[model samples]
Target: MNVAINRKLILNILLFVVMIGVIIFVIRDSLSEIFTELGKTSWPVLLGVTMFGVISQVIEGYTIKNIANEFNREFSIRDGFFASAYATFYRVVTFGTGSIVSEVIYYHKKKLRYSEGTGTSALRMITYKIALMIWALFFLVVKNDAIQRYITNGTFLVIAGIFVTLLIVSVLLILSLNINAQVLLIIFCNRWFKHQKLRDIVDRINNQVYSLRAAIKAFIHDRNAVIRVFCSNMAKLVVWYFLPFFILVQEHPTIDIWLTVALISFTVILGGVLPAPGGIGGFEFVYVLLFRNVVGKVDAVSSLLLYRYATYLLPFLIGMIYVLFNKQRQINHEFKKAKKRS
Candidate 1:
């Protein structure tokens, strides 16, 4: 346990150091410029927009809870949202796999059955990835020529191909599974993470394979829940895209909303794929490269930084607070329960 703590601490320090280095490398003397643009930003709008983002994140957590319900278990809304925020915060702290760790911790703390909690979290992960791929494909094949002006031909082509392939493969696999949740999950887990211990755990809960099937069938057969989740995610993505337009509104009274949306959305999709914490350096680098083609390099960099602050850092701080408070409350609740039992 001591070794684990030391390793985690070391990893966090390294991630922070790397993030700082990336920011320095990208901004250099432009910190002043970044700050200047930041000062010009409308705080009210930023707050409102970020709150909407947070609400969307809460919806994501609720979506997890809905998946859990299929297995006849549940988590409170507050606990679920807190779990989501902390999971995201974990990503920033660990630089990777923090979200997974956070979910596991939250599940145990919430007293959710292990099968139900892990299953719900896994389903949420799969759905989120699929949703992102869906949006990416829509942008790629449909709006390629327009959005490509901001991004490189090479990069656009690569991203588009990936989304298209994922869409095709996912559809084919789901169809082949015929909504057999366990088979799909087993194949997925085995293909990605070949852990003997995980296999053992999965084998223990093999009965829940029927529950998995039920959930998938509900997703396809019922349709409303799936549609609701899809629409909710789409609305969030739209808000995410609109940030660039709002940022530009301060400069130009009339800006092309579609272009701004396309550019920001494309850049964000790229960040989603990159192996970085909250898509930090990877996101900024993509924006710098792409936005420079359409906007000046300086402004492009500024926009990237602004969006990062509005979308990433601000949420990270809020999530940290949420996690801290939630942890205290959770501990207190547990203590009361123990006292009552005693």
Candidate 2:
């Protein structure tokens, strides 16, 4: 167990390094242009971006709170916000499915049962992704020309096919709950793990998965709870774009507000869909590419920088601070608990 934990730690560290390298490489040229443009940005515009960011965070907090409520577990708004902040920080560095490790840690610290916490987190994440995709699809309808040009036909076709496949799989799995997960796991393990020992371990996982199915079914059965969570998550997705629209308005008051909102909405969804951590390179690249055609080069660059600063870098820095603060508090709490037990 200790060896496995150590291996995971090492693997995570390697992934973090790779992700950071990718971020630096992608942002290097863009950062220079963005910084140059930043000098010309008005103080009021920057202030507006900051204020809008804070407001967006409030929406994010409510979404997490609603997700927690879906589990019939009440968590403080501040806790949810900070936990999410911490989760974002970890995910950016890790850049894999294991980006979920932070959520597990946060739930463990909150003293929630592991199954409940993980199930709730998984549900919330799925709902959040769906909300984000819905926002993206809506913007795509409005910004069809821009999307058509930016999203290559081949790429769009591939994404569409993958999305449909995932939808069908999810529906089938949900319908055939228990056996499906096991069969899926077995097939997944057989393809992925070459080692016989690992294959057997995965078979053991299939057996243990029955307990997880029950937990998931219990949570899924709550239709009202799901709707409440979905609505809250959707609201957060809206705010993601709204905040950027506010930033653009502050800078260039003459711009079409609805179009700006639509553009930002599409970019936010793109960021969420992109695999890059914090959507570092992915967001800026897609935003600049699309925005350049819609809004002029100068405005696009400035607007992209301002938007990125408000939405990505600013949150990243804040999450770093929160992670540090949270880790310190956690260490202190653990020490106290240890002392009490002693």
Candidate 3:
């Protein structure tokens, strides 16, 4: 038991260290210019825009709360906030898996069943991804030019292709989360490929997927709650995109906010596929490269830093406080208990 705890501690420390290293590596070349832009930034506007970060947290937490209500579960709104915030911390610290793990942990600590935990987490991600797909369509209509400009950049083309492919796969996976093994086999695989071992494995997976799907339908049964959660997540998406909007707003008043948001969304989607923690290395790299084409190098780099800080770092700090100071021990305790029960 002590050995297991020690191993987790080591892993946590390693992931944190890697997080710092990636951030430093990302900002290495832009250090001077980023600082200069930070110095010149309008504090009042910047600070005001920062509030959107807090608003985003509220919406995310509320979305979780709504999901809980759908389950008739007894999770508190405060726990909802911590779940959303700390999950972001997990997402960053643990790369990306932490978000769902934290959500499940939140429920486990509340003594809720695993299905509720997982269902709530899955619902949050599904709604967010669907909203992003809608954002892509809007981008195509309003900011086609921004995308067109980057089409000639080889890096952009590669990243774009990856993003599209992942988006398609993600959509399919989410839509098919409820599908049975037989249905999946019929739609995706052939009879020739089937075997006893494979069928057994597929059946086990299908059982879990069916269970999860039942949970999903239960949530959707509360029609008003479903709509509220969906809209709340969409609002969160809007506010998050605004962080980048404020960065480019001052000198480029003529700039389309949608265009700015779309590019930011593009960076997020593209960065998400990268194999780095929370898309750290990949997000920063592609964001800087693409933004440099639109704005100058210095402004592009600086704005990227500001936007990231507001959207990522700020929430991450609050989340760490919630997890480290308030909830981490409890969640870890619950995880251990659950493991023992199994």
Best by TM-score: 3
lDDT of 3: 0.68
Lowest summed lDDT across 10 adjacent residues in model 2 is found at 153-162
Q: lDDT tens digits, residues 226-283, model 2?
A: 6776787777666667765666566467776667676666665554355455545766
lDDT of model 3, residue 137 = 60
Structure candidate 3, residue pairs in collision:
none
Q: Indicate the residue-level lDDT of 216 in model 3.
A: 79
Encode model 1's per-residue lDDT on 1-342: one tens digit a residue.
555555555555565556556445434453445456667667875665566567666666666665555554555556666667667666766666567656766776777665555555655655666666667667667667765555446455548646754775475435434546556766787787678998887665454444344446545554666666666567656667777777666666666676667666667667545445553576787767666776678767766767766556555556667765654565556555555555
TM agreement with the true structure for every prediction: 0.66, 0.70, 0.71
Give the clash count for model 1.
0
Query: Per-residue lDDT for 1-342 in model 3, tens only?
Result: 656665665666565566566545534542444455556778875686568777887788788888877665676667777787777776766667557767677777776677767767766777777777667666666776786677455345544644675576475456445356437554564465477887676665554455467667887778998789878878888888877767777766776776678787677666655455553478887787677777778777778877766667667768767755543465466557556655
TM-score of 2: 0.70
- The lDDT ranking, best first, is 3, 2, 1
Q: Pick the candidate with the highest lDDT.
A: 3
Better of 1 and 3 by lDDT: 3
Candidate 3: regions farther than 4 A off = 1-42, 153-179, 182-208, 272-280, 327-342
Clashing pairs in 2: none
Q: Candidate 3 vs. truth: CA RMSD?
A: 7.1
Better of 2 and 3 by TM-score: 3
